[model samples]
Target: MYDPAYGATDADLITFMGEEVREESAALGRRWFLVAELAGRRFPEMVGRQMYCADSISSVAAEISPVLNISHSRAVWQVETAITLRDRHPQVFKRLCRGLIDYRMVSMIVARTDNVADDVMVELDEAMAGRVEKWMKLSKNKLRDRIDLFIAEFDPAAVRVPPDADKHRYIDIDPGDTAGTAFVSGRLHAEDGAALDQRLDALADTVCSNDPRTKSQRRADACGPLARGEATLACQCGLDDCPARANRAAANAAVIHVLAEQGTIAGTSDKPGYLPGFGVLPAQSVRNLLPAAQTKPVTVPTADTAAQTGYRPNATLTEFLRWRDLTCRWPGCDKPVQRCDIDHTVPWPYGPTHPSNTKHYCRIHHITKTFNTGAGGFTDEQLPDGTIVLTAPTGHTYRSQAHGASMFPALRQPTGTVETTPLPPESPDRIAMMPRRRQTREQDRRERIATERRKRTEIITEQQRQHQAWLAATYEPPPF
Candidate 1:
């Protein structure tokens, strides 16, 4: 192919290429919005014409693929997601349609807003308008952080409910057959998880002299023997004698220690309880774990008692706080509380050292709390329920919800086996075998519009015949 751009200067070529890429991304975003629009417009007309066997969205989508020369699945997905984004974040969607943001940015907006209530979504969408350029400069993770911050401030309801343990929990072991090893992973409730992580750390610290293995490598190597009940965590550093063996007593004391509300423990009412580092568990699970657990009761300070002690937390209070907060107080940061610095949200001695005023923050966020000031920096206010709503200098609010605060605990465990019923075989009429066609332009491929429409029409007519015959032979109207 002859190329006019081949003669251009390098700088011009780079500039032109970059501009085209951005515009093309914008064009595609607009095109998808149209796809959703087209489906809506053509659907009623198709219904009026009665060209479809059914009047549902699925039937409408089926016709769009053949008419436009696109895949039926792609058309449906684009329409559904586009419509959702439009409703949830109109401002961002408009910018995307105008080519101001790429599809990737659109996707990030969608992802971060997942599970957020619609009213909050609208608030977030309106909030993004003027600051999008600044957001563009951020890394994807940082952008996600910004979105999360917005959601927390605007819609704490989504963050308030921790992901259901039963739904999210799973265990997977990948066997590297030839490598003679397997990788195992799954979610554990916070309290159980902390114990496992602690044990791993203890074993990881047991290094022989001249250990060349990185901390991660040592941790990885330590898991096998710990699982197998072998205490020797020897490193491959070629040392004749290594002396960093951990105290078995501390490492072996890993156990679940849930802090159930005393009322729930006594069975008067089913108050949800917490497992530090894990999340809220039902009163039943709390009761289930308690009979086997070794209990050490620590008194949590009341505001009156806390204020009397010059606002300073005593050893008992500190221990209770560590147990209550298994990780950093920031919304999603999970730094273990044992290793975190206790920070007063309202910087002491101005703020009391009471449990209500104190929060656990990892070193990084601790500094962010101290130094982050002005409009862009973050500040927070704590609610009585332990929900902390943080506000950016920009005035957007975000929040960290208190975990283990379930209002209604599931006392009875869920019990059911997945039912696997076989679907009936597809009738010939329900199947469409597309005719082979020559390759076309990329845009045509995406749009599913091509010169093959006429030829494909013939294929559809023949399939309809087969479908009618099948209906004649097998259709059965359900008896009233």
Candidate 2:
């Protein structure tokens, strides 16, 4: 038997992998085409329905979900994507069949351009078909920007804004694999999450430094006191004069930083505001925050004023970077600037403290960039317009542009030019100063699991004892 891959070179293998991806994309396009055809057959049955043909489409999706091994909602979404692509964006659908674009990108295109008028859709389809093939390497945010730019330019009314997530806030507690444990998760408004996080941090810090529990553990324990409306968490240290307990004060107020255009702050422009850790805020939501917010006018940096001689950026430059970078500049990393470190791309003194030479990187990635450099390590390069090009040890390169700049084009303006000297040679004996954990990850996990299980068991026992007492008190003989 012949095995073509037996003697394949790395380059050959890479090419083959890309070919496989293209084929998979083409197959998915064909599947969507068939789904659209099947759905078209049900159009007559869907006519003049109470919900404007929603029921018939739902029935089709319900029937397809089982056969496709997908959820009913997912099936319905796929059906909509298929119909939109087949009917409204036929040219783009043709490209999908040719493996020029994948289904995920197609789905995004369909969703963002969904509100385009029937006549306008034809033009958009033709325009997008000509451009989408070149967008293969774009990041998710950049891809959305590309799609949106066209939609905004062609049909401003058709541009789709993300739905207000606050309307769908919910919390869920699911039983864990261990009998007595549960996992808590939820979605909250940005302000609520910020306030809760601040309160938890404040409570967690009330315990003395001598407490045995890790910071994370203390934070988890703090939740109990917070729920009970307590002002402080009890210190675990045995010392009678525990300084943390003595110095504790009420939780500090949570301050949420939002960046918006002056027009947006007023009632004039509806441009959305950027919430540092969360995401984009609708214009109305931004205005709603103004009542509780301490408004400060931040100077947007220009090319001339972007550079400073000091190690740290000035407030103006910092604010500009926040608006420009929005999140950690690492490819595929979306940690917001609120939780990120301002990193010097070319390493400080050698490179001036300037926007062109700096970008946001979360602590982990900042350490990774600092420690991992030179041969067999990741390399980073930044462009004047806040684009970062990262090369991996594997030699694969990823280019990420400033996310905020895509949403607000003004942020794309280039900053001041800075002269940089070459980085000094690495020292052979210098050790990387990475943070070490007190406990191994496995030990920490085991401890957490044990604590949760014990707590849950205690809660169940208390509930059972109360139930028994109620039964004993209410017991009465039947009057038969």
Candidate 3:
């Protein structure tokens, strides 16, 4: 709170100024904690209005987004991270409050330890004691390295990555300050990077005689035509063993996995199409990704939907299960289905290869389930509609429902809790004729609002119906 006037030549001015900045940062952290506390405290008011937990949290996101001029996702992250900082690392939270460390330094610790076991976190808290200042002084990467060392020493599993870490890759499109464009960034495996480098470099040099764009700009420009299907993709480096060395048709290179309806794919409807791993893509993008998106004929099984005798599924069945689960069926893991082990809810041979009996799970969660299932740690039960409820060792159960925009967006989740009340016929209509006319903006907004509610409700209703039918058929009620 020191406001030094222009001519103040205090001997310790530099030190004092630095101290002020740190103090202010600590104050900011404390303020953020208060804000998150407010959100939790206000939850009841929103829920009392019959809003689902997800919607209530979205209220928090909406409130903070414009106030901070940040994206809703970023706003939600700030709130979630603050809550985790306090819940998982109270000592570090205190350090943040006292200005002993800045939020980013605390965030480094949070990232490394959030997914770790609770007991491991307690050990981490003990190990990190009295070192807050040291961590704060180090560069971010150095601090992360220190945290990694601690995780390795205390709980080696805490730093463990999936066996398929090489498959871990993603692209991020960051919107830049100057409008209409985004900075596309991504990480690829070494071989893939080398392949992409050759392809991009070749494209960049193609027009070198007249192109005045910078190398980075040229590469960026070159990616557009390839994605939009205007240009081809191939390894021009002539490297024999290069990953992209094999020639692929332009369409095949940009082929994306989508589960769009025949109507949506045919341009008859504009409902956003579902892309596995990625949620929904605009209709045009879906159409462009696979213009001739053919619908594979699905056999209408005479037997139960969940019934099959084989242990391993065939190609068609595999695709069905992948798109069916979308991600790992573990309570909160979102590992893409492509990277999961299709696991049986009921042990194999006993469970059968039916659709109902199996779900996808990442390796870690699959291992977790292997040990967790049966008599002790956890139990996985699949509902009639493929929603899974995990019964924990503590007896508290959690549900993981299949959700996507494909015909059934009924998997929308309400974080922290799942409200199972079916969404009523509250709207006269939820759709409008497209090219997305200007007249129905209000209706579109209303539909989006109802969507989250309806999805959760539908799943809940299905769960209730299945449970009720089971009880009626099997469990006999006493004369109480």
Number of the top-ranking candidate, with lDDT as the measure: 2
Instruction: Give Cα distance to truth, residue 222, candidate 1, Å.
Output: 18
Per-candidate total of colliding backbone pairs? 12, 0, 0
Displacement of residue 434 (Cα, Å) in model 3 is 54
TM-score of each: 0.34, 0.43, 0.46
lDDT of 2 by residue, 70-127 (tens): 6445776778778878889999999998888997788778877766667788888899
Candidate 1 off by > 4 Å: 1-252, 267-272, 282-284, 308-312, 323-327, 332-336, 374-376, 383-387, 399-401, 404-480
Q: Model 2 — TM-score against the truth?
A: 0.43
Q: Report the candidate with higher TM-score, 1 versus 2.
A: 2
- Candidate 3 per-residue lDDT over residues 259-374, each given as its tens digit: 76567677998877665644666677677756444556433222334355577876655766676678777654566787889897776765666556667876645654554334
lDDT of 1: 0.59
